[model samples]
Target: MEYCDGGSVVDLMEKRGFSTLRIGEAVAIILQVLEGLTYTHNAEIPNVRLADGSFAKGRGLIHRDLKPGNIFLANVGGKQVAKIGDYGLAKAFDQAGLSGQTMTGNVVGTPYFMPRQQVVNYKYTQPDVDVWAAAACLYVMITGYSPRNLQDQDPFLAVLQNDAVPVRDRTSAIPQPLATVIDRALIDNPDIYYKSAAEFKQALFNSIS
Candidate 1:
């Protein structure tokens, strides 16, 4: 793996004293992450070179864990670039069907960035879970707080019982169109929201452009 000398997004947040970043910085980071996710979600499974100089057909991958801590920054051509990291919880979908459990009865992921569906079943999670988490990361960067309240309640329970706090509710400084895009991405139901990173990225572009 290439080294990311600039550190993770969480490090940047901490360095800024947990204050929100400028709109441009936050959007730039998120756009980079979304681009990475677009590629990752559509990556070919079992993407390995065979001894006979052949390859096998495959399916998409689901990155079950995505948060500011997992997004690293690197200095590339004098510009800081955001890159997705830590795929310990990533799972590949089956070639036969998009739905298949990689494991059973396992709950893994940062509660602050996870959606309800991921909390319910991490093993059978889909790509949209990553999109939700990406939005959560953006939300934190813009609001200095997680989308869900994490104060006095059990984190896991809060994930299951609470809806994501609207981006504008945390701070009205966010433009309505941008807020709408981020808020929609954090919706608990992946089937109804951005089903892939490409979709989420397009929505973001449309909102800003």
Candidate 2:
């Protein structure tokens, strides 16, 4: 791991003397994270044979603990690149079952960013959970508050009890298109949720474009 001179996004917020970062800056950083996630969610792991002597295809990895504090900024060729770090809670979905560190039915993640489904089934959480956390990071970056207000409530129960507040509700300055993208990504329902990081990234791109 290389050193990041610009520090984490949390550090950036502190340096700015405000929790919320400029919308443009926050979007830029999150776009990079989405790009990283696009690759992570579609990674192909080789050399694993399937049931009938056939190698399995692509493998997807989920970073269950994605937050502003875990995203670090590094100077690369005069550009500040946002890199996803602290993959301690990362899980890969393949034919070999859960990875080494994964424990079935045990919840482990930052409550503020994770969706309710993740809390319910952390071991089997899919890539959309990471996408939701990414949106949560963006929410805090631009709105200066978490999607759900967890004050005076048990952190664990808060995740199961509350849905994310709409971005525009927290701050009306956000444009509807951007807010809609964030809101849709944060939806906990299975039927109408962003299924993958690429899906969320495309929605975000379309909103901006």
Candidate 3:
């Protein structure tokens, strides 16, 4: 493990007061995380064995837990780089056995960052889960708060009830287009949300351009 002298993004936010980051800096940090996910989601790894002693390669992995605390900042070449860490809840999906659904009765991931699908149907592996979580992270980065409107109600219940305020409504300083991108990524509809990390990255880039 590389030493991240800069510490977690959450630490930085706390030290400087959240929502103090410049738009470019916040977007750059988030793009780094998305870039990491682009590789993680597509990387091939060994799959678990089946009852028949048969096994296959898993083509996609989901980072069931993604939040500010899980993201580290390391100084690389005199520049700080955000890196995704903590794979404790990561799960792999077999491409050959992908039925668009996986069984799971228990909820995982931080409550504030979890997507509605994760709260409603814990039994499934979807890349969109990370996408939504990443957007939640972005919200915190830009607004100093969770998208769930934690000040008004319990964040866990808000997530379970799909009660999230639009990013634009939370922070007017954020560019409307960028806010829209984050909002769309946080959408509850997997079919309509950013489908892949690459797509999410592109949308983010477009927002800044």
Q: What's the residue-level lDDT of 171 in candidate 1?
A: 95
What stretches of model 3 exceed 4 Å from their correct place? Answer: 49-55, 95-104, 150-155, 190-192
- Candidate 2 accuracy as TM-score: 0.90
Clashing pairs in model 3?
A: none
Error of 2 at 35 (Å): 0.6
Give the alpha carbon lDDT tens digit for every residue of 1-209 in model 1. 99999899888988988778888799989999999998888887765323354645656667788998899999999999999998867776543222233335668788998898888866567788889899999999999989999789999999888888898999999999999999899888534388888899899988988
Report the poorest 10 consecutive residues by lDDT, candidate 1.
Answer: 94-103
lDDT of 3 at 54: 70
Q: Which pairs clash in the backbone of model 2?
A: none
Model 1 segments more than 4 A misplaced: 47-57, 95-103, 189-192
The digit string of per-residue lDDT tens for model 3 on 78-152 reads: 998999998867766444332222333666668888887777755455787888788888888888778876557
Clashes of 1: 0
lDDT of 2 at 114: 87
Ranking according to TM-score, highest score first: 2, 1, 3
The predictions' CA RMSDs to the true structure, in order, are 4.4, 3.3, 3.3
For model 3 the TM-score comes to 0.87
TM-score of every candidate:
0.88, 0.90, 0.87
Against the true structure, whose lDDT is highest?
A: 2
